[model samples]
Target: MEKKLTKDDLKEIENQLSCPSGSKGIEVAVSMNVKNISMTKASIDLLKIANNDVILEIGHGNCGHLEYLLNQAANIHYIGLEISKTMNQEAILNSNSLGTSMNTSFELYDGEKLPFENNSIDKIFTVNTIYFWKNPNVFLQEISRVLKKNGVCILTFAQKKFMQTLPFVNTKFKLYSTEDIILLVNNTPFSITDTIHKKENIKSKAGDDVDREYTITILKQ
Candidate 1:
């Protein structure tokens, strides 16, 4: 039988999920890459990438899907921004291992402001990272500012109800529903172009079989 998690264990999981670090953080990131692959692919599809497009992904833990994303189009450049140093290094290492180092780059940030100029990026996306945004409203503006006119930003996250069931999602995590996110977007500069709710049968991080409910919110400036 699997060992039960203690209070400290759950808290550690929550912290690593937010901004991974150390050896435990590395392990957690690898697990996250597996768990979030489907969500990542779905978000990538919504981006509608084209030839020579500049793509940005926030909180790209280890970026194990970089090859799949690069194969979407010709001559694409991918930039991964992360708050976790471990994740930043791991992504670069993984990209190198995949022989995709030339076309990809990874950087660490404060998770508050994006380190790019206005109207710089062609497409932006983030999966399961919305819950950690220090200020969604202001950060949405940053996303808008960095994106060129008519740029697409796909935000994917599990619904509040589903996320609440996770043992590791503690007070540090801010869960949201479809309605809550829609309302939040309404207050931003970008307009919601599409909202997709999806469910999948998968094994949870805690090693339990369950149904996962998530949403993909597409935004345009």
Candidate 2:
């Protein structure tokens, strides 16, 4: 039997999920890598990655899938951005260890503003990061600003209904339904080219089996 987590324990889990740090954060990063791999792989496949494509991934925790993304194409340059210093450093270490350092770069960001120049990136994708966006509208415009014309952006997140069931989600997470996200995207510079609905049976943070319903919204300018 497992001990129950207190409110403080849940809060710590929430904080770590938002911006991991310290030794515990490193552990969280690893856990996230394992839990998020399916969504990450789906997002990458939606990218339809091509040769020499410059790809950007937001909130790439530990980026355990960097080698997988690099394997999708030839001459692909992958850039991972995170608000957590621990994730940034851990991703670098993981990339080096995977021998994917040559084609990948990691950076820390303020989470509101992207670091690349306008029209610079060929493809972009983010998994489970939209809930933390300070301003989803402004951030969508920033994504449009950096993404090249016709560039694809894959946004994946579990729906509000599913996310709300999690004990640690709390007020820190701004949950959304599929309708909510489509409406938000309509106001941005990009158009919703595709929305893929996904479901998986995964263990919850507190260690229980649950059905997770998520979405992969593909955006293009």
Which candidate leads the pack in TM-score?
2
- The residue ranges of model 1 lying beyond 4 angstroms of the native Cα positions read none
Number of clashing pairs per prediction, in order = 0, 0
lDDT of 2 by residue, 1-221 (tens): 88899999999999999889999999988888888899999999999999999999999999999988999999999999999999999999999998888899999999999999999999999999998999999999999999999899999999999999899999789999989998899899999988999899998877778999999999999
Error of 2 at 36 (Å): 1.0
Q: Can you give the TM-score per candidate against the true fold?
A: 0.98, 0.99
Q: How far is 38's C-alpha from truth in model 2 (Å)? A: 0.6
> Which runs of model 2 end up more than 4 angstroms from their true locations?
none
Clashing pairs for model 1 are none
**Candidate 2 — worst ten consecutive residues by lDDT sum?**
201-210
Residue-level lDDT tens digits of model 1 in 1-221: 98888888888899999899999999998898888899999999889999999999999998989999999999999999999999999999999999998899898889988999999999999999989998999999899999999789999999999999989888889999999998899999989888999999888777777899999999997
